[model samples]
Target: MRNVERFIGDKLQERKDNLSIRSLSTNIPPVDFCSNDYLGFARSGELKHMINSTLASMQNHLNGAGGSRLLSGNTRFTEETEAFIADFHQAESGLIFNSGYDANVGLLSSVPQRGDTIITDELIHASIIDGCRLSHATRFKFYHNNINDLESKLKLAKGNIFVVVESVYSMDGNIAPLLALSDLCERYKANLIVDEAHATGIFGANGRGLINQLNLTKQVFARIVTFGKALGVHGAIVLGSQNLRQYLINFARSFIYTTAAPIHNIVAVNCSYQYLSKIDHQLIHQKITLFRKALKENHIKTLSSESAIQGILFSSNEATKQAAANLQSKGFDVRAILSPTVALGKERLRICVHTYNTDEEIISLVNYLKELN
Candidate 1:
């Protein structure tokens, strides 16, 4: 065999050995407790109407952005949406990115200088890890959500330190100890960056996210909010000071090299946010109430999260997959986050609750898991 083919074969074997071999597949056609569409805005009538109305106006931008944003892609709509996001999040400026992944990679890699230190929670999302690898700064990882551990490292941390964390941890379905972390950052004179991906459009008043709900924007350095999850579209925006925005535009490669996202991603995001802002309170409330009640009734133990994501721990990978398969056969969609996604023995079935999920649907699905898996 060729050397390249042999190398590829060895890599595939490694993934299999670690049980980390992922493959693309289609929907199993059950109640979706797996997607990131928190508000059900992905299929919302109002958002759809907004897009249609915009299209009907025949005021379309070009299909592709055709180049990097700094090159030829920057437009009135891009600037307009950036302003809207910044003002909405109460930040001084906003820089749109291709996706949450790119945003994280770009910001994490670029922001910290050569002598700076980035001490992040051990369980920060993968993009942050990749960004840290690409960055020039020294990196440290404290235990997840352990402020004391962070403080211990803080004692030794040198040169402009930037502490990074997520407001809502994706795999664990739990929040970071943000207030404590914020105060600690302030005390140490360190910058804080909070990824508000999971909390956006759920936690804060008007769904700005956990940081905004706790009013930590002024204290934190940056907030990264994505449109795909709660906002129910594609792309993301990093909210920060005008200085930070200008700096990223000058240095962030992810922003400079990649062709900008299509105008549709921006358009859909704007439409979705507009719908969410004016949405009735009862939309999420009734569903959340039903979901919580069902969990309580079934006694299906889960992590403590009032947000859209939920976790049901199952110790073994086989057990987790069997449970997911059983629920899948029963016409419910669920997936398991195996070891390495979380710590070993902390594997869980990551359940996502949605605003459009009906009371009956939640009840039936929970009961199905109880009876079968």
Candidate 2:
């Protein structure tokens, strides 16, 4: 026990020394720049009302799912919701998971066989990386958003090749070249898996995600969409063919072993999807434009992203942390992405633009960013 304590203490001390220690804080500022509530749905009274109303209408008053989906957890309502989400995303089928992390881990760890090869984007989410770590397949990483590098890796890959990427990368706030990647996968007869975590409820006509927006739903093999991001709810869905759905139901340990999300959470997810069609997503695009324009006017460079997520790179973790602290002090609620999370010198201030942020607020945030130097 003492040895275990010492090991934990040493690891924490290492983090502290590197200024990369992480802690939870409920000290959110009043400003609306740091959260994943891109459409303001997370805080929406309308969404809450919808959820409550839906729950009230449901016959099942059970607080919990009782067991895993494979056991007593499965419900008609849950299966119906999955079908609805799959159809909305133009997928053949959908399987619900507790979270995006679970969906990624379960899908990646279960599908790819020992002789298979998994190639991922260098800047893919940590969840995907962890998923790959659990897989028996050989793994490779291509340069971020570089098709040539990806093609090179694809050529070198053996067995069933799986190419994984995020539609909108979480940290860098950059989008994947899905069309090119899909084409490459087709050329190599490889499978393409897109994690649309940050894209769901932020793109497409009814927030079906980037795959739907780009009309690549038929081209891609699978997609992982989360409700916690722009939908402002909890849970995730893995969209794919009916066969894949069945396979995951039987083989995905994370889904088969874990208790299902409660009835209330599923109701909230259903309500959120219904709310997606009514959302003025254009408002979010306007905010993103306003933010970019403000940044350009202030001559403050940011990562190349038309999405709601934006990043401003800093040379060191200390500088990035200080910038985030400065923004937080000014009540902006912006946060820093430090080393180890990213590469050592690639630390950044990850800013999220939301539909609720006004033009004045965007300009003010940019002005404060300009003052950071």
Query: Which candidate's lDDT is highest?
Result: 2
Clash pairs (backbone) in predicted model 1:
none
Q: Which stretches of model 2 miss by more than 4 angstroms? A: none
TM-score of each predicted structure versus truth: 0.95, 0.98
lDDT of 2 by residue, 113-192 (tens): 99999999999888899999999999999999999999999889999999999999999888999999999999999999
**Residues 24-96, candidate 1, lDDT per residue (tens digit)?**
8876665788899888888788789998787566475688888989888888887898998888888999999
In candidate 1, position 201 carries an lDDT of 86
Per-model tally of clashing residue pairs: 0, 0
Report the lDDT of model 2 for residue 64: 91
lDDT of 2 at 190: 94
Error of 1 at 221 (Å): 0.6
Listed per candidate, the RMSD to the true structure in angstroms reads 1.6, 1.0
